[model samples]
Target: MQKRYRIKREKEFQEVFAAGHSKANRNFVVYQIKKPGQTHYRVGISVGKKVGHTAVCRNQIKRYIRQSLLELSDQLPGDVDFLVIARANAKNLDMKETKTNLIHVLKLSQLLLEAQAE
Candidate 1:
């Protein structure tokens, strides 16, 4: 994932977690904050340690989420900051499945502009 696309700062993450509203489905939790902006949609994916204790497992899930996001990043609106939080199910899910599920959640939450078929 590109550095500019990610929400890297601790303070930014905290503000999103605390002030942003979220909607959860079976596979992922979507937290979104709308910042009036002209460029870039800041995004972050968080998979909790409770989901998996091992580093390999956690990294794999993060990798899957990151890859999925990279594919759809261009379609995301510029003024919104999105945080995708993976659940325990993320550890075992495949790239295609995660992407399908994430797109579904994004649509249901009315966050994404494009239509979701899955």
Candidate 2:
């Protein structure tokens, strides 16, 4: 993801955590706030040591979540800031499951613009 589309600063994460509405499944938590003037979505991913003891494990989880978001970016709402927090069970999932679970969470939160009816 490009710098403009990624939320990199500490304060930005805090702002999202403080004000964004959130929803969660077993492996992930998503926080989002809609800002009126913004023209694109900015996302932050957080995978902590609690989720995995090794850096590689944490990074792999981050990569999977990022890939999922990237795939759905075009259909996601533009004026929102999203923060994705991975839970410990996330470390146990493979790439495909990660993407499916992430998309499921997005759908539950009503964040997926083109989400289809079941």
Instruction: Judging by TM-score against the true structure, name the best candidate.
Output: 2
Candidate 1 per-residue lDDT over residues 32-106, each given as its tens digit: 888995487888888889888998888888888888777877668888787888888777788898888888888
Candidate 1 lDDT (Cα, 0 to 1): 0.83
Consecutive 10-residue window with the lowest summed lDDT within model 2: 109-118
TM-score, every prediction: 0.91, 0.95
Clashing pairs in 2: none
lDDT of each: 0.83, 0.92
Instruction: Give a tens-digit lDDT track for model 2, residues 46-72.
Output: 999999999999999999998888888
> What pairs collide in candidate 1?
none
Model 1 vs truth, CA RMSD: 1.5
Worst 10 residues of 1 by lDDT: 109-118
> What is the number of residue pairs that collide in model 1?
0
